[model samples]
Target: MKKRLVVAITGASGAVYGVRMLQVLSQLDDWESHLVISSSGALTALHELTMRRPEIEALADVVHNVRDIGASIASGSFQCDGMVIAPCSMRTLAAVAHGLADNLITRAADVMLKERRRLVLLARETPLNLAHLRNMTAVTELGAIVAPPMPAFYNLPGTIDDIVNHTVGRTLDLFNVEHAGLLQRWQGLKKTAALVKESVSREHLISI
Candidate 1:
């Protein structure tokens, strides 16, 4: 059976993460993506990516309305492999931390927790307060990964797309999704140290 993943977009700053994840999933034949975008998420996408709801929904194999509490993904028997809330807002984080299944996005997250399925949240916020930190801790205790979209400088990303791709790629890594060439992998620093040592030896021989 094709692996199923639930992708939710909340009202966060980095909607591109969610959209990029859907784009990557769309290219994988062995994977199926179910998308749910909150109303505020839709607005944020428009503001950030200039993408309409239809345009974003097109990337998913199936799209569920945020208000649809009866969606298949909201049930533990849905047989989903995992769920990710890319660019998860602080509000959504609090809801999931407190087990508030008020909307379909949070509802499906609740299902993932109850079923012991993988749940990843790309929490997007800066200058986090105590409440945010405590909620993050709560979600962590509940088996939900609160992965904020922090950029890695080791990749030497040249453009915004590169940074975004690296973030999305790392998120896929958590789900064991195949995303080759999406970002540069870290090679050990031992090679660089060896090169430096060789250079120093050559310099010493020249001095002699």
Candidate 2:
């Protein structure tokens, strides 16, 4: 049986993370992806990625309507390995934190929490207020990982796509998804220095 993962794309600014995640996970033979996108997520996709609803939905093996509370994913018996809310908005975060099952996204998330399944929330926000902080803490207590998409400069990303890919790669890591050697994983300082020297040597040899 393949591992099942539920992916939710919220209204947060980084829709590309969820899009890229679906794109990659769809290709993995060992995993099946169940996708749910919020209404505001569709808007953000249009504004941030210029992606239409169908375009984004096509990336997943299974698409669930956000309003369909009776979806199979809403039940813990569906047997999913985990759930990830990429670019998780503060609104959705609060929803999941409070066990509010007003929508499929939050409902599925609530099921995961009650069932003790791994739930990763890539919460995207800045200058968080006390309410936001408390909400985050609330979710943490219930076993949800509040992961904000903080990019690492160590990769020396050269483009916007690079930064986005780096974050998407890390977010997938929380679900134990392999990158298929696409993204650069962080090696220790010794290995990094050696890699740098090897790259320099290769460049020097190329010039020679």
Candidate 3:
């Protein structure tokens, strides 16, 4: 059975993360993605990625307006496997932390919490002050996975796509999604050793 997934894009600087997440979700056969974009998110997507709002909307299986508090996702009865907020803003995080469901995104998040569904928050902010950490702790206590968008250098990422894929792959991991060709696992390093051995052999022959 396909899992119902809710993806919310709040007012954050990293709109590319949200775009890549939607693109990845579209390729999944066993998942249905419901998307909600905050008003500032739309602007950020346009300014950062130069993608039009309609084009962004087309990426998701279902698009819900952020202002629509009456949306089905806001209710606990709407059965969803999990909810992910890619590039979650501080404002949204704080709102959800305090149980203030003023908008559809926070409201749906609250529903996920109350319903004991998986909630993954990709909090995108820097220089975490005490307040941010406190809010994160509060949500974590409620069974929400508060993942910050921190890049990993072990992947030897070369391009922007590499970074995006690594982040998305990590996000998918929270939902137990298997992602290949994104990041190499530690066990996969065995292949790199073989390549290095071959390179060393070739170098020795050339030197001889």
Top TM-score hit: 1
- Alpha-carbon error at 91 in model 2, in Å? 0.6
Q: Candidate 1: which stretches are off by over 4 Å?
A: 198-208
Cα error, candidate 1, residue 15 (Å): 0.4
Model 2, 68-185: lDDT tens per residue? 9999999989898999999799999999888899999999999999999999999999989999999999999999998888888887888887888888887788888877654688
Q: How many Å off is the CA of 145 in candidate 3? A: 0.6
In terms of lDDT, the best-performing candidate is 1
lDDT of each: 0.96, 0.91, 0.89
Across residues 86-134, which tens digit of lDDT does each residue of candidate 1 receive? 9899999999999999999999999999888999999999999999999
| Model 2: number of backbone collisions | 0
Q: Give the lDDT of residue 50 in candidate 2.
A: 91
A best-first ranking of the candidates according to their TM-score comes to 1, 2, 3
* Model 3 lDDT, full chain set: 0.89
Identify the superior model by TM-score, candidate 2 or candidate 3: 2
For each candidate, how many residue pairs have backbone atoms clashing (under 3 Å)? 0, 0, 0
Clashing pairs in 3: none
Question: On a 0 to 100 scale, what is the lDDT of residue 78 in model 3?
Answer: 93
